[model samples]
Target: MLMFASSRVGSVSAGRISNWIGHRYTIVVASTIFLLGSVLMGYAHAYAVLMAGRCIAGVGVDFSLMIAPVYSPKISSPSSRGFLTSLPELCISFGILLGYISNYLFGKLSLKLGWRLMLGIATVPSLALALGVHRMPESPRWLVMQGRL
Candidate 1:
């Protein structure tokens, strides 16, 4: 899980060797794939499918986990940067909390669909995150670097 985050986060930093071609797009695409893969993994009955889904999800997780810290500070003001830096840790805890709550709830359902439901539940957040990104502004630092500021 940590390694997956590393990959996602790492991409958000400098990106890739061929990123000069379209790194930002690649990261977004990869993130989407990861999110979808995670949801898919939960429902996957076959071991191979589950593993593949996990791997894809890991890639996407890597993209988001790595990207935030890599770019957040560059755009944050010094006065509030410390708080901003803590957001990732907070997010991690929140995610874990949510997962535990959800798993506990699903575990009580006493049905096959219950397990699947728990895994598929992640799709909602992934969709929300994707939409939120589309609605929000690009990084101010990135804009400034591009001379849009």
Candidate 2:
């Protein structure tokens, strides 16, 4: 619940910040925050700490969700932009399905370790996203907005 609330707020603010800076940097920031949140949740010693981590992760999730569609179309060729823009939504659905599968697999382990692993696993992809985006060109629309084009 708290996570969802924070995500809503974060998405709105992230849009404004993305416009000021650029989508690439914004996504990097989002991934970093998500990584931190995942780590925090995995190591949480109390309910409060877990909730705090969830809230942070929520914001990160929303930021990525809000920006990916905008960023993909801006960088893709017109003929492919429709497919590229839709990828985010498709990926999100797949991610949720994966999460459920992960939970089922992890549930067989000891409670303490299983849940931690489930939460921490998210950091792997977030780290990859943070690193991978660095090599990609910035959205052309953002470059034009910055008067670089």
- Best model per TM-score: 2
**Candidate 2: where is the Cα deviation over 4 Å?**
none
User: Model 2, 1-149: lDDT tens per residue?
Assistant: 66778889778988898988899999998999899889999999999999988888888888898888889998889999889988999998999999999999999999989999999889998999999999988978789999998
lDDT score, candidate 1, position 13? 46
Please tell me which predicted candidate would have the highest lDDT against the true structure: 2
Question: Per-residue lDDT for 105-147 in model 1, tens only?
Answer: 9989967778777777777777666666554446665565566
The RMSD of every model to the true structure, in order and in angstroms, is: 3.9, 1.1
lDDT of 1 at 21: 21
Q: lDDT of all the models against the reference?
A: 0.66, 0.90
